[model samples]
Target chain A: MDSRVWDNRAWLFVVPVMAFVLFSSLIPMMTVVNYSFQDSMGQNSFFWNGPGWFQNLLDPTTAVGARFQGALLRNFAFSFTVLAIEIPLGIAVALCIPKSGWRVGAVLVAIALPLLIPYNVVGTIWQLFSRTDIGLLGVALGRSGVPFNVTQNAGSAWAVIVLMDVWHWTSMVALLCYAGLKAIPDAYYQAARIDGANRWSVFRNIELPKLRKVLVIAMLLRFMGSFMIYTEPFTVTGGGPGEDTSFLSIDLVKMALGQVDLGNAAAYSLVYNLITLTVCWMFFTYTTHADSKDVA
Target chain B: MLDRIGLKRGDEVHIADASLELHAGSMNVLLGPTLSGKTTLMRLMAGLDRPTSGRLVEDGRDVTGLGVKHRSVAMVYQQFVNYPTLSVYENIASPLRVQGLPKAEIESRVARAAKLMRLEPMLKRTPAQLSGGQQQRTALARALVKQAKLVLLDEPLANLDYKLREELREELPRIFAETGAILVYATTEPAEALLLRGSTATLREGRITQVGPSAALYREPGNLDAARVFSDPPLNELALTVSNGVAALADGSRLPGDGALGALPDGAATLGFRADAAAAAVAVGGDGRDPSHPAFPGTVAVTEISGSESFVHIATDAGLGTLVCLVEGVHAFEPGDRAEARLDLARAFAFGADGRRIAARPAAAPRREPVPA
Candidate 1:
């Protein structure tokens, strides 16, 4: 056996990337951790608070605590609600896309256009579109004699935000599902037909089961994106109407930049990060476990 | 017991017509070459696709308008049909579940099918856990669970190895006998066609060329094409000229026969003979110099020896191309050797320019079935 031929040179190539990631991610994360546990009052003068900020954030009475808790609940509800609607809608659209030719290409392009738009730009665009004065949507609603204010009403604001997010991100789920549908071998459908499966049965037994792997991926990605929704809602509503439309990220920004409470903001940010990571972890574990059982 | 069924497809095509009748408790094999409409015919029978102008009838009832689920036909595709995400048990039980069968019934059927396929130990294992042949058996078990009256096997064993193919061949007939369901299987291999040896038919260019017993079709083909297709080493065809009560081979040697050439053509005619037919009365002489001998001198062009017999390709002196003959054992004959071949006049067939038999000679034995309707 020629053990000397084994390559150790790959690590040398990976050294720069490892160093870059450490500087870009690990270093900033360390600074956030340091600020989380300490209170720096002025001019970089720091004192150890020993979990004082954590205690305050968990109290549910402080401004940071109230804003964080409210936003967390709202975000969780929004993500799940959006997920329930978008996943099925995406799969339906994917199923309708033809398998080949210019028509499929046109559909792919149309579905992908919204996903290509920058997130902040999506928020700004939706903000303009929801304006009561000049926006077409607002004018159309006005003509219908309905109260069409998105900026002043928290419910209307949340509705617009959810709709906008669905318009922008549902295509991603559809595209993933479309790719999955395309990869399904035609033999399965033929067999299903021969086994005397009707359309609904075919969809339920064959298509859905086969799409399980892709559906999991779409679900996880959509969940994480919706849970961490910040830029679009922030630009569209600016967290107005007494913190009703405000999410965790919006509250985090208010703590760090508005009140200049870096320690509390860092603690809030850490807690926010933990929540997103935990939810995502739970989703991944649950889906993978269920899939394994199906496999078994 | 699977009740008898019937189907009809009157789809017009540029080449040939298509119509098939499948009976319950009988296995029907669809044999054809490429582009012979075998798959299309199978799909129509399975109710996967509709015909332009045809109806499928079962037990004297019109079932053409019914969807696949309404019809009770199960199919095993050439590609394995196990649900990739589901375990072996789940895959087999799916058809039963679709029928809204009781869970106990589903369990019993799945267990029986799995046991028959030798997959009981791997019930909880997914499709990826099994090999290709095992996956195929899982698919077969799934179809069995469906309990459909007609089992359509579309080239089921096409992708298997030789040994697996033989094993499955023996197993498939057993299953068919046990279920007593009509089996309509498609295959391209002539050897596999012999395996069923049932009511077999050859579909060519979208039409049925011949339908009869496998052995009968093999022994006496109605036309030259059928004979050429049916034989193992194909029947040899050569051009000949018959003049004034004497039929001469293309090599200019007269075929020895005491028969009149009635209404014979003046110019060219096609002569046919199977390779295994024998020739006698060879005279030892220079290139066909012995006029009294019945043999014609030809050069042995090529020889391919296979264990018990050999295929000899010979070119005669009359400038005809290679003629193939099956000779017994190995013969030490090189290319360009002066060889004398005696004609087997009794086995020879003569056809006119229109590709129809011209000779009124009686066959070796009585042919069955009113000249093949």
Candidate 2:
């Protein structure tokens, strides 16, 4: 048996990353933890609240608790909706892209264009692009006799938000899935053909299973990205048409910056972060477990 | 008929006018070197790719326009492409599942194929957990479970180790024989072609040069390319002068004209000799010179000894460059040793300027010459 040499010297290479994380992440996180338990009055004077904010935030009777529950439920619904539409749409687009040719590069560049735009820029672009009179989509829908006013209608507001998110981020999922699809050897496709498998059968047996790992990653990224969505909806909808599209991040910002409720916002932040982390961890664990069972 | 069928990528032809009739229940080999269109021809036959011009007719039905999914064909690739996420059982049952076969029937067929490939123990394991040979076996089992009318194995044993290749090669024919599919096996190794002993079709440079029984093609290749394809270690070719019913070597030795050479027009020709033929002549006549047969003196350039056989490379003065002679057991011929190899004119092949074999020579007698110890 070969024994590994004990080398303390290798730890030196890790020191820079550890120091960066300490300054960038741990310090800020500790500040949020400290703020979650204390109430701040004028002139930065503070008194211990001792979980008062957490208890009120957890309850549904108070205004803060009610807002938290509404935002949390809306966030879950929005995340599930985005995943439902984007994952399949991304897979379909990925499958439709040609396997080889000069067109592959052109198509990939076109798909990746939306992802390169800044979040606020994407929101501003969509905001102008969906206006009732001048915006192309709204004007076209109005000309076609459809009642489409994102500024006044809750359904229209949700529609525009979901549509904008899908248009901006589905390409990310497609690119990830395309990378996974490209890794499969041509031999697999050839073998599938020779096995007399139909198109659906081929996709079901070969392509989908091959894309499972990439799908998990796409799901987690899209879930977290859509759950914490603020700038796009805030810029385009302004959490408006009566707080219809206000997700958790937008509500958190409203409570902390707009209402100046520092203690409650801090508690909300910790709870929100915990919820996202827990859900993502569960998804990761489930997928990895399924993958291990497959190999076994 | 693949009358005008060819494959061209941009401007270059991959397989040009490749037409052949394959029979059912007999293994046919597409034997060629690398990039010689063997796999292309197999793909065309299996309906995986359409010919640019020609149509494929199977049992009097034109299948050129039909896709692979519409055809009754199965294939085993060189890379052992099993579904990585699926167990061996599901991989084998995949085609049946596509057909929507009854679950019980699919299970029984999978079990049968698994038993035939000796993969019953690993039925529940995924391809990633299996060895290379086991993965190939899983692929073979998948192909067998389909029981398609046509089976194309594209160098299936090429990626396997030596012993595993030998073992699988022995079992391949037995497995296919029971399925009654028209099996088309492709390989670059001449020894593999000979071992499979199928009706071999020799291909070269996107053209089917010759088609015949494997042993017959080995014994009488139709052209220079076919001879090269069927020969291992390559046949030794010599540029010689034929004048007045006699072939004269560069070393000034003359071989009397047989019936085949008697009809030649007395000009330059190519002489082809297998390694074993050269060794036989060298073994019987130690001095590498025999009066009754054409012989030449040469120095050994290189020697390779493998197990019970030794291949001695000889650089002859006959303007024939180097010739490799496979001597049986062991010989004491080292590099730079002076040796002579006699040519049995009757057993040798002659090609004209166009590289087509001149069939004028009578078949040689099967008598072994005595070693004059």
Candidate 3:
């Protein structure tokens, strides 16, 4: 084989993407970094704080620090609770989808309808549908002797938020799983049948192994989306009945807009992003490492 | 044994009423081109697919509705399917494990198959880690471990390299035949069919053209379609018009029609020959004067010299069209050079207008003739 000649001209094509990233993400993120290091007052007046806000945020004794800790734990709880119900439910739904014919197109279009809805629209729709005073679900629950209120009950508020999250995003997981399932060759199923494998053995040994890559992707996307969730709960429960459903995104917005504390909000935002990135990285390496080990 | 199997999907008939009797301890080759229903026929025989029409009886019992699982069958698909995440050892052991065989028995069987396929060293690696031939070998090893009554290999050697294909082409049929299983191997290469030297079934457009002993079938194809199916470089076709016991082409070349070609009811017909049986040489005068053979002036379109033979493409004069001639020993014929092509009439077969053989394998010999003025 001939040795490849090194060409540097390809770097010019990457310049446009770099410039676009600079304007779209890097510059704005630099502003948050600037705020994290300074103290801000009314009228955009600022003083040099030199990590003082970050120090207080990490201490867990200050008011902002306590709220951050509470919101962080609540985010973990909500993320796990939603994912536990969504993953298995998504796989089941994906498995039941018709493999071929016009019905496949119809069912796929129906499955994707919820995902096409805008976030605020989904939140508002659920709010009207679950209201205790005039909502069908709330009325039915109230009449059935189950205490259901978004405003006065913490347990009920958590339930509605979890249910709404599941309803909104299980479709994402299911669609990803469906695509993965469709990519598997029909020959694998035939070969398994010839080997006399039963249904569970086929799923465990064949389908699950083939689906691992897509499942990892779905897990990461859903984990981040669930951990940073805000819109549905904000419109429905208002993160209230106490701080039960005030996840990290809701708490960050509250510190930034509701409390008008720019310094604390900026610091919280950076740490929240760092946590999400670190956890996702850890999960990816752990799972992929296990994957290579499984093959080897 | 396949009894009148047919598969129709929607309005398209994929396998049109095909039947063959497959016996144990024998090697059978399904020779056909792509989309010729070779794989579909094999799938129907394996019970992987149920025929839309007709029944499949095996061992004198009807198995049209029987699933592949309940039947003792193993198949290596064209696109070899091994558990991508499992080691080669496990891939080969999968069937034995499913059968709940003892660990010692499974180990011995897998080891034996691995040895036969030369896959012993790569037993610990996965399919993703193996090359195409090694992956194919892993799939073959899996099929071997089953020791089933019916084994189907769909283009198993098509993806292998030239040397590996030749090597496995010899070993596979022998190994499967040793188990006394009904082995059905499908390939598009007619040379492969000849090499396997078993019973050969030639298929075309979902129809079985002919099935018999391989060498004898190649010698005397039941019809023109079967003869064409058994040709590697594609059969050469020429139009012949026979009138009052004399056959002539549009280019003024002539042949005595007292032969099998004339045995046709004295009208327009087709004459087919193999590339190797025809020869093309640079014209040095006296080109279109031979009456006992097909002699026509042509212009060389291409010349390919390979190994010990040369393939010369010539566009014949008149409306005879282009024909390929495979000449033994190297011959240099450049493009645009005038040449003469001749067919060995003794080896040619004549077909009627509807593509059915009028007579098999030179039923009438060409008689010596005088040059036409």
Candidate 4:
């Protein structure tokens, strides 16, 4: 194995990226930390509170605690729902796509189209598409008289948001799976055939086990993306009809930018970041532990 | 016939029709060069590949269409075909599992196979972790784990070092003896075929050219090509002519060998004899009148000595052309030494112009054992 050398020369290439990240993230983080330690009196005047904002965050009796927990639960629910629908569907689509020559190129282009559009554009497109008067989906629902109004209805808004996400991001999972599928040597399939494995047995014994790594990666990415979802649901529902469609990020933004309580917002942002990190860490630990158990 | 249970690549009708009958408990070696379709034929025999035209028959019943898994025939391929993902134990037990055998039976068979192959200690190791020889043994054990009726080995020892090959060659026969199954092994080496100690078949260009016991084929090949196929240094072939009672050569020198010249057809003939069949001696005092043992005077052209014996390539004026005489013991003979080469009368082979073996005359009767009487 080639041991890595701590070449200061390589830092020349990485320094720009680090600098950009520091400017974009570290500076804002320091500002948040500064705000998190003080209470803002009107006109940017601050009084030192010394973890007062953290105490308010921890206390369930506080208004902030109640709203944060509710939004967190809703975020978890949304992420799980999207994952439940997308992973298997993505895998199925990937498997069904023809794997040879020109046909694969066509299928790849078709699958990649949804991922190529910008994130905000995706939100705007869905926003317009789900409108009652101008959108085909809304028009069809209206024609069918299926009482559908995503802006006012929490269930409908959640369904549309989940569907929009599955439509946009399922391709990522499919592409990963397709790559995994392509990497499998044809000899393995030949061996399976010689073993007299039926179709289901082939899938169970070979395909599923081989796909384990990529599927976990796909699940983690989808979970993180769906958990932090903001643009599409926010654009469509405006976090409106009360707090019906307000996810965790939506609530955090509402506190930060809507209420202009910089101290409280900074505290909420820190809590939000910690929650995402904790969940992701837990997921990673669970999967790696399960894999080690299986290997043993 | 294609109807045999062990028919590998389907036999083609356009080719010569031949059926192989290997008795149970016998080891049949398929000997041929690479790409000569030995592996294809073995796969057909193992029921891995179906012959498009012929039927595979087992005990007079057609089994041509049966798949490899259902045939109860195990094949160890030329390539290391062990399952990379499975440990040695699992690989051996796979055949039993496929057969839907009981757990106890599977366990016993796997244990017995691992023990026989000396792979018990490495049962938990994956194929990649095993050495080349160990991997090959695992492949062999996997075949033997299921009580297969016919075991096909496709150059199973080709990948091993010479030392390992020698060791495994000694080990394999004992393993086969214990199993009591019909073993069909293919190899490019004639020595391997000889080591098999059973009936041997030679394949060339997808056709079986010859089949017989190894010793007989080595000693008295069926034809000129078969004779050439057996010898290590290869048999020496010379063109000869029959005129008067002498076999005259192109150099116009007549041989003094006492052969049944009367038995040969008049005109051209190719005399075939192995290098070892010629007795090398200095100009000896003998009449050379024996009709069986013929003699020729020739100049030694080349001498290759290896330990106990040396081969002298003789350039003779006789129609024998170039004769290789095998001389035992060390002799101080340079390339230009005048030498008398004697043919081991009974051992010489004669081939006709069309590359077929010609019959020789009946041997002279041996003298009675008067002293014993």
Best candidate according to TM-score: 3
> Candidate 1, which segments miss by more than 4 Å at Cα?
A37-62, A98-103, A142-148, A274-296, B1-15, B33-35, B54-66, B82-135, B145-147, B159-163, B215-373
Candidate 1 residue pairs that clash: none
**Candidate 3: lDDT over CA atoms?**
0.85
- Candidate 4 Cα errors over 4 Å, as ranges: A1-21, A99-104, A124-147, A239-242, A278-296, B1-52, B75-94, B118-142, B150-373
**Residues B153-237, model 3: lDDT tens digits:** 8898887899988999889988888889989899999999988888899999999999988887877676788989999678888
Residues B258-316 of candidate 2: C-alpha lDDT, one tens digit per residue: 44444665787788878877762243344444444566568888888886988888887
DockQ score, prediction 1: 0.30
All candidates: TM-score of chain A: 0.92, 0.92, 0.90, 0.88
Q: Residues A204-253, candidate 3, lDDT per residue (tens digit)? A: 87888889888888988999899878887899877887888788899899
* Candidate number that wins on TM-score, 1 or 3: 3
User: lDDT (0-100) at residue B140 of candidate 3?
Assistant: 94
Please give, for residues B26-69, the per-residue lDDT of candidate 1 as tens digits: 77777777667677777677677665555567888877656776
Model 2, B171: alpha-carbon shift in Å?
Answer: 2.2
**TM for chain B in all models?**
0.75, 0.91, 0.93, 0.79
Candidate RMSDs in order: 7.1, 5.3, 5.0, 9.4
Candidate with top DockQ is 3
**Where is the poorest 10-residue window by lDDT in model 1 chain B?**
B1-10
Provide backbone clash counts, one per model.
Answer: 0, 4, 0, 21
Among all windows of 10 consecutive residues in model 2 chain A, the one with the lowest summed lDDT is A287-296
- Docking quality of model 1: it rates as acceptable
**Every model's DockQ, to 2 decimals?**
0.30, 0.36, 0.44, 0.10
